[model samples]
Target: MAIKPAEIKKLASLSRLVVDDKTITDVTDRLSSVLALVDQLQSAQTESIDVSRPFHIAQRLREDEITESNKIDELQATAPEIYNGFFAVPKMID
Candidate 1:
Protein backbone atom coordinates (compact mmCIF):
# COMPACT_ATOMS: atom_id res chain seq x y z
CA MET A 1 0.00 0.00 0.00
CA ALA A 2 1.20 3.49 -0.90
CA ILE A 3 1.60 5.89 2.04
CA LYS A 4 0.41 9.51 1.77
CA PRO A 5 2.46 12.65 2.48
CA ALA A 6 0.01 13.69 5.19
CA GLU A 7 0.34 10.29 6.84
CA ILE A 8 4.14 10.59 6.72
CA LYS A 9 3.98 14.03 8.32
CA LYS A 10 1.69 12.66 11.04
CA LEU A 11 4.07 9.73 11.66
CA ALA A 12 7.08 12.05 11.84
CA SER A 13 5.28 14.25 14.34
CA LEU A 14 4.29 11.23 16.46
CA SER A 15 7.81 9.77 16.29
CA ARG A 16 9.44 13.20 17.00
CA LEU A 17 11.55 12.95 13.82
CA VAL A 18 12.79 16.13 12.14
CA VAL A 19 12.08 15.36 8.49
CA ASP A 20 12.88 18.12 5.97
CA ASP A 21 10.20 19.21 3.47
CA LYS A 22 12.29 18.12 0.45
CA THR A 23 13.09 14.67 1.92
CA ILE A 24 9.48 13.83 2.77
CA THR A 25 8.89 12.21 -0.63
CA ASP A 26 12.05 10.08 -0.28
CA VAL A 27 11.08 8.97 3.20
CA THR A 28 7.57 8.18 2.04
CA ASP A 29 8.87 6.12 -0.89
CA ARG A 30 11.23 4.16 1.41
CA LEU A 31 8.46 3.53 3.94
CA SER A 32 6.10 2.38 1.18
CA SER A 33 8.78 0.07 -0.25
CA VAL A 34 9.36 -1.45 3.20
CA LEU A 35 5.64 -1.96 3.69
CA ALA A 36 5.36 -3.60 0.25
CA LEU A 37 8.27 -5.93 1.07
CA VAL A 38 6.64 -6.81 4.40
CA ASP A 39 3.39 -7.54 2.57
CA GLN A 40 5.26 -9.77 0.11
CA LEU A 41 7.00 -11.62 2.97
CA GLN A 42 3.65 -12.15 4.76
CA SER A 43 2.16 -13.73 1.61
CA ALA A 44 4.96 -16.33 1.28
CA GLN A 45 4.08 -20.08 1.56
CA THR A 46 5.87 -22.09 4.32
CA GLU A 47 3.31 -24.72 5.32
CA SER A 48 5.62 -27.74 4.74
CA ILE A 49 8.91 -26.01 5.71
CA ASP A 50 10.82 -27.07 8.86
CA VAL A 51 12.41 -23.80 10.00
CA SER A 52 13.98 -24.99 13.32
CA ARG A 53 16.08 -27.98 12.08
CA PRO A 54 19.10 -25.87 10.99
CA PHE A 55 19.58 -24.45 14.53
CA HIS A 56 19.73 -27.87 16.20
CA ILE A 57 23.36 -28.68 17.19
CA ALA A 58 25.31 -30.30 20.05
CA GLN A 59 27.35 -27.45 21.66
CA ARG A 60 30.33 -28.45 23.84
CA LEU A 61 32.45 -26.06 25.96
CA ARG A 62 36.23 -26.45 26.54
CA GLU A 63 37.49 -27.08 30.10
CA ASP A 64 38.99 -24.06 31.91
CA GLU A 65 42.70 -24.21 33.01
CA ILE A 66 44.71 -21.98 35.38
CA THR A 67 47.87 -20.17 34.15
CA GLU A 68 50.53 -18.14 35.99
CA SER A 69 50.84 -14.39 35.14
CA ASN A 70 53.53 -12.41 37.10
CA LYS A 71 53.23 -8.79 35.80
CA ILE A 72 52.50 -6.80 39.02
CA ASP A 73 55.97 -5.22 39.22
CA GLU A 74 55.99 -4.33 35.47
CA LEU A 75 52.49 -2.77 35.64
CA GLN A 76 53.15 -0.89 38.93
CA ALA A 77 56.18 0.85 37.33
CA THR A 78 53.89 3.12 35.20
CA ALA A 79 51.42 4.13 37.94
CA PRO A 80 51.37 7.75 39.21
CA GLU A 81 50.44 6.50 42.67
CA ILE A 82 50.35 3.04 44.27
CA TYR A 83 49.04 2.04 47.74
CA ASN A 84 49.18 -1.48 49.30
CA GLY A 85 50.24 -3.19 46.01
CA PHE A 86 47.34 -1.61 43.99
CA PHE A 87 46.98 1.42 41.69
CA ALA A 88 45.65 4.49 43.56
CA VAL A 89 43.06 6.48 41.63
CA PRO A 90 41.41 9.80 42.48
CA LYS A 91 38.18 9.59 44.52
CA MET A 92 35.09 10.80 42.67
CA ILE A 93 32.23 10.57 45.20
CA ASP A 94 31.66 12.54 48.41
Candidate 2:
Protein backbone atom coordinates (compact mmCIF):
# COMPACT_ATOMS: atom_id res chain seq x y z
CA MET A 1 0.00 0.00 0.00
CA ALA A 2 3.00 2.30 -0.41
CA ILE A 3 1.89 5.36 -2.45
CA LYS A 4 4.37 6.52 -5.13
CA PRO A 5 5.34 10.15 -5.93
CA ALA A 6 3.45 9.97 -9.27
CA GLU A 7 0.34 8.46 -7.57
CA ILE A 8 0.45 11.22 -4.88
CA LYS A 9 0.59 13.88 -7.64
CA LYS A 10 -2.39 12.25 -9.39
CA LEU A 11 -4.41 12.11 -6.12
CA ALA A 12 -3.51 15.76 -5.31
CA SER A 13 -4.63 16.86 -8.80
CA LEU A 14 -7.94 14.94 -8.55
CA SER A 15 -8.67 16.16 -4.93
CA ARG A 16 -7.42 19.77 -5.60
CA LEU A 17 -5.00 19.46 -2.63
CA VAL A 18 -1.76 21.47 -2.47
CA VAL A 19 1.18 19.32 -1.21
CA ASP A 20 4.96 19.91 -1.39
CA ASP A 21 7.51 17.09 -1.98
CA LYS A 22 8.23 16.78 1.82
CA THR A 23 4.47 16.82 2.64
CA ILE A 24 3.82 14.25 -0.09
CA THR A 25 6.44 11.92 1.46
CA ASP A 26 4.92 12.30 4.97
CA VAL A 27 1.31 11.88 3.74
CA THR A 28 2.32 8.83 1.66
CA ASP A 29 3.86 7.09 4.70
CA ARG A 30 0.86 7.94 6.96
CA LEU A 31 -1.73 6.86 4.35
CA SER A 32 0.22 3.64 3.55
CA SER A 33 0.27 2.71 7.28
CA VAL A 34 -3.50 3.40 7.61
CA LEU A 35 -4.27 1.29 4.51
CA ALA A 36 -2.04 -1.53 5.82
CA LEU A 37 -3.99 -1.54 9.15
CA VAL A 38 -7.30 -1.61 7.21
CA ASP A 39 -6.00 -4.51 5.07
CA GLN A 40 -5.12 -6.43 8.29
CA LEU A 41 -8.62 -5.71 9.76
CA GLN A 42 -10.27 -6.98 6.55
CA SER A 43 -8.48 -10.33 6.95
CA ALA A 44 -9.52 -10.65 10.68
CA GLN A 45 -12.44 -12.78 11.99
CA THR A 46 -15.03 -9.99 12.79
CA GLU A 47 -18.07 -12.30 12.36
CA SER A 48 -17.98 -13.39 16.08
CA ILE A 49 -17.86 -9.70 17.33
CA ASP A 50 -21.08 -8.78 19.25
CA VAL A 51 -22.91 -5.71 17.87
CA SER A 52 -24.63 -4.82 21.25
CA ARG A 53 -21.32 -4.87 23.25
CA PRO A 54 -20.69 -1.15 22.78
CA PHE A 55 -24.04 0.53 23.57
CA HIS A 56 -27.84 0.29 22.82
CA ILE A 57 -29.75 3.34 21.53
CA ALA A 58 -33.55 4.00 21.64
CA GLN A 59 -35.61 6.97 20.27
CA ARG A 60 -38.43 8.35 22.46
CA LEU A 61 -41.25 10.37 20.83
CA ARG A 62 -42.56 13.42 22.74
CA GLU A 63 -46.24 14.58 22.84
CA ASP A 64 -46.81 17.75 20.76
CA GLU A 65 -48.35 20.14 23.34
CA ILE A 66 -48.01 23.85 24.32
CA THR A 67 -46.34 23.45 27.76
CA GLU A 68 -45.98 27.20 28.55
CA SER A 69 -47.09 30.50 26.94
CA ASN A 70 -45.17 33.84 26.73
CA LYS A 71 -46.20 36.89 28.85
CA ILE A 72 -46.96 39.82 26.42
CA ASP A 73 -47.09 42.47 29.26
CA GLU A 74 -43.40 41.74 30.21
CA LEU A 75 -42.32 41.88 26.55
CA GLN A 76 -44.22 45.18 25.85
CA ALA A 77 -42.68 46.82 28.99
CA THR A 78 -39.11 46.46 27.52
CA ALA A 79 -39.99 48.15 24.17
CA PRO A 80 -38.39 51.58 23.25
CA GLU A 81 -41.76 52.90 21.91
CA ILE A 82 -45.07 51.03 22.44
CA TYR A 83 -47.99 51.98 20.16
CA ASN A 84 -50.85 49.62 21.39
CA GLY A 85 -48.53 46.51 21.72
CA PHE A 86 -45.49 46.78 19.37
CA PHE A 87 -41.78 47.77 19.51
CA ALA A 88 -40.79 50.78 17.34
CA VAL A 89 -37.49 50.95 15.39
CA PRO A 90 -35.75 53.51 13.12
CA LYS A 91 -36.81 53.44 9.41
CA MET A 92 -34.19 51.68 7.21
CA ILE A 93 -34.88 53.73 3.98
CA ASP A 94 -34.15 57.50 3.63
- Number of clashing residue pairs in every model? 0, 0
Q: State candidate 2's TM-score.
A: 0.42
Worst 10 residues of 2 by lDDT: 51-60
- Expressed as tens digits, the lDDT of each residue in 4-62 for candidate 2 is 87887888899999778868888888888888877776777889889874767676788
What is candidate 1's local distance difference test score? 0.88
Candidate 1's displacement at residue 7, Å, is 0.5
Per-residue C-alpha lDDT of model 1 across residues 1-94, encoded as one tens digit per residue: 8899899999999999978899999999999999888887768788888977667786777668656598898889999999999889889788
Top candidate by lDDT: 1
Q: What's the distance in Å from true for residue 94, model 1?
A: 37
**Model 1 bad stretches (over 4 Å):** 44-94
